[model samples]
Target: MNASPQFRVLRSRATETHNNLREEILAALESIIFESYHNSFTIRADLEVAFAAEVQSKFAVAAHSGTMSLFLALRACDIGPGDEVITVANSDISTTGAISQCGAIPVLCDVLANDYTINTDLVERSITDKTRAIMPVDMHGHPANVKALRPLADHYNLRIVEDAALAAGACDYGLPVGAFADVTVFSFSPFKPLGSSGNGAMLVTNDEEICDKLRLLVGYGHDPLRHGVKDGYQNYTAEGYNVPLDALEAAVLSVKLPYLKEWTAKRRAIVAALQDGLAGAPARLPSFRPESAPTFRSYMICVDRQFEIYQGLRAAGIEAAFSYAPPIYQYSVYAGAFPNSNELKVTDRLAKELVNLPITPEFSDSDVEYMIETTKDLLEKT
Candidate 1:
């Protein structure tokens, strides 16, 4: 039998980018070997500057993982026990996990039927005295109703921590996703659009005070006390966690940052082709406003017989999938811990219908044609 189509989801082009930056990586490695690996004033520090600029933010704080970025963002927003943070139910577990880790209640909300982002209308009603913040994730590399949510958050005097993990190069209304929220978090997991060689994430913001708090929080609550110690003691100012990005990952991310826009464009091109080809197919594809652009992190579509199609695709050597079926509350672990919005009809419907297909930038014309024809063929047969 022929090999299955290597449909690697959230595929990272890190290998290609790293190969291009081979000499730089080696030089950075040698520098680390000789200088004993300084986390600050090195590749990691440079990355903070470069990445912050790429995201159009005034400050960027690197972290060990995206979850850490989200946790710190939530903490910076003063979300914790008794404080409710409204967010969508259909997303990577990381989204809600960050809220839960910070001791905040994640009030699950439904996603819009068209784009599968947070229902901005549900947000205002969900806000009570305890709702301290609203975390709108950039679902499927497309902007949520973040701008619409801004008014609600402002009216309620709540913070907004945007999760742009899958939207590294996406823009909303001409502004990068990172530039529009109180604090925006981007993940560099190997699968993300702007992934690192390994794992890394960034928290970007324009607010100096929040930046200061996050910077200090990542370093065991050290109060801006530089490399050495004052009076032979490092002051632990607040309860914090030690979560800084690795220098090596930073080095890799630095190399890939420049190509992010090009890569995102490629993903968009492929999505356009697929959408055009599958015009009348029996699946609901993602839709967005003209002002917003998505990286098409994954091509999410809704269809009946989703499981049957998913299994058939796998059997036919495709890596098609349904990213977050059943939403969060439906998961066995948190079945009873969280309540599904009383009217998550669309969320529940999508839980059974949505499927993610290969939309990588590296896809060749033939590769994409194969995906389109294969999907159309499968849909017709099913």
Candidate 2:
């Protein structure tokens, strides 16, 4: 059997980029190791500046990870035990975990079949007296229907915390993803659209009060006046947690932030090529609207016999797998907890059919073509 061209070409280029990025990371480590900072404030300020420039927000807070970012944002908004947060079940488990950590109930909602984002009508219907917030995840670098969601939130007096972990450069109409929500959380994990060598995360908000509260919550609730404490006896104002991003990781993330726009363009180009090549294939390509621009963090498709296709791609030396199979609600931890867990029809269908293909910046035109051809062949032959 002849190996697919994607196996021979795509993997090599991705490995090359990985090696080069590792060297650049080492050089950054060497530089930061010698720099002297007067206090932790300096590092925080640098991150704030970098984030503010990228998201066009006045306030940004650095967190230990994307999960923590969501937790802090929820906490700052006063969402705690007994509160219900409406969100989709077709997202990474991190979002659900964060909600549970804050002692809030996660109300699982179904996603649209076309875009794979939370259904706005379902979200509106899920609201109740206990509903305090709605967390819409931007799945696969595409923004959810935040414009419609904003109005619904205002109607119900609910807070909107956008999980934009996959959407670094994603924009809807003319507005960026972060600009539409009350609070937006972004991830800097190794697999995100704009990732660091290690874990880091950011929270962006235009609300000063929320930003101030989040800062205090992440910094042990220490009053600014107690910056210089004597004899290790400092007064703590409120209960909080230690969730600060490492300075070294922040430095590396700052380096990659500048190239995000170019990288996003490349991903879109590749998705377009794949769509065109597989126009008549049996597999279903992602459905993106004309008004939105997705960063294409992962090129995903839904099809029958998804498991067979997954194994076929692997045998062909193409790394493909289910993105979020066995939806979050099906996990043992959330088995009977989430409300409406039994009614997630679309979510259940997607969990069984979604397959994520490699769509990194390193993939070439031939790599995309081979993916389309191989996928078609597998679907037909099976």
Candidate 3:
């Protein structure tokens, strides 16, 4: 009988990404520490410009986290008290929480069984006289069909705030994922595709009005009227929060941003290999539309025995995670908050079955092979 393969324990992808960029990150830090003295905002501003250019947006606002970016985007859209924003229930709490934070209601929309993104066809039906915005999450780095929702949002005079926290380098319809939304947010938390050492995010928009609102909200409502005045007097136009992106994190992200495309390509290749290796292996892989090009945060696969497979992978030294299951609406914190939760049949099914397998640019070809073989063995037993 053949002996079992000894696989290296895969830990955090973010750590590997950081280790890989150690030199560049150190150089950026050195420059910021010595040269940037008292001009810390300039580092963040440079990142915002580079990020905006990369995402093909007219303006970008850097924020402390993706959650804050979502909130700022919602506020920029004037979504508040009694307004309803349609979003999916299968995403992280940040998606729904952003809407609720603004005193607006989040109308739960179910996701597609295949891609696990918001079912855009059903989004319009959720719209009401009070519907103010549509927030679609690109769950597991799969690009939601925001392009389809663009016309719907325009017709309803609604705003689309895409939560692409996991999809910084993804593209859809031959353009970056944010191209179709009024404002799109990309996260730089360590676990994301293009990650910084600490929490950071960028909100990108083509609308000058929305851009101004985001800046105002991020800078403690510092008067945009006096933005070009050059005077040091602090003035306020509206009540807002101070949550600008951390300058040091911005420096790290600036060093990493140029390598995003390369890392994203590596992620896609890893998913491709996983897709080919796991085919017909008692697990269901996610499907994407031809126009969608996704960068995987982790390669998600659904199986009948999610927990068993997840545990088995961990035992075999693969860092498989069982999360986002049972749906967010089922969480105790949300108990009875979303009465329409029962209607999310597909979302419920996905949450119960999904398991995320780690994928990183640092993964070796042998590492991917080990993952495939080990997961296939686990799935076969289940």
Clashes of each: 0, 0, 0
- Give TM per candidate: 0.93, 0.91, 0.94
Candidate 2 residue pairs in backbone clash: none
Q: Which TM-score value belongs to model 1?
A: 0.93
* lDDT (Cα, tens digit) per residue for candidate 2, span 93-204: 9998888999999998898888799888878778889999999999988889888899889999999999999898898877778787889999988778888766888999
lDDT of 1 by residue, 184-263 (tens): 99999877888876789999999988988898888788755354577886767677778888877776777678889998
lDDT of each: 0.81, 0.81, 0.87
Q: Best candidate per lDDT, number?
A: 3
List candidate 3 segments past 4 Å from native.
1-11, 223-232, 340-342
Per-residue lDDT tens digits for candidate 3, residues 130-213, read 889999999988999999999999999999999999999999999998999999999988778888877999999999999888
In candidate 2, residue 157 scores what lDDT?
96
- Which RMSD does model 1 reach against the true structure? 2.7
- Cα deviation at 126, candidate 3, in Å, is 1.0
Angstrom error of the Cα, residue 2, model 3: value is 33
Segments in model 2 whose C-alpha atoms lie over 4 Å from true places = 1-15, 18-27, 37-44, 223-233, 340-342
Global Cα lDDT for candidate 3: 0.87
Model 3 residue 197 distance off true place after TM-score fit, in angstroms? 0.7
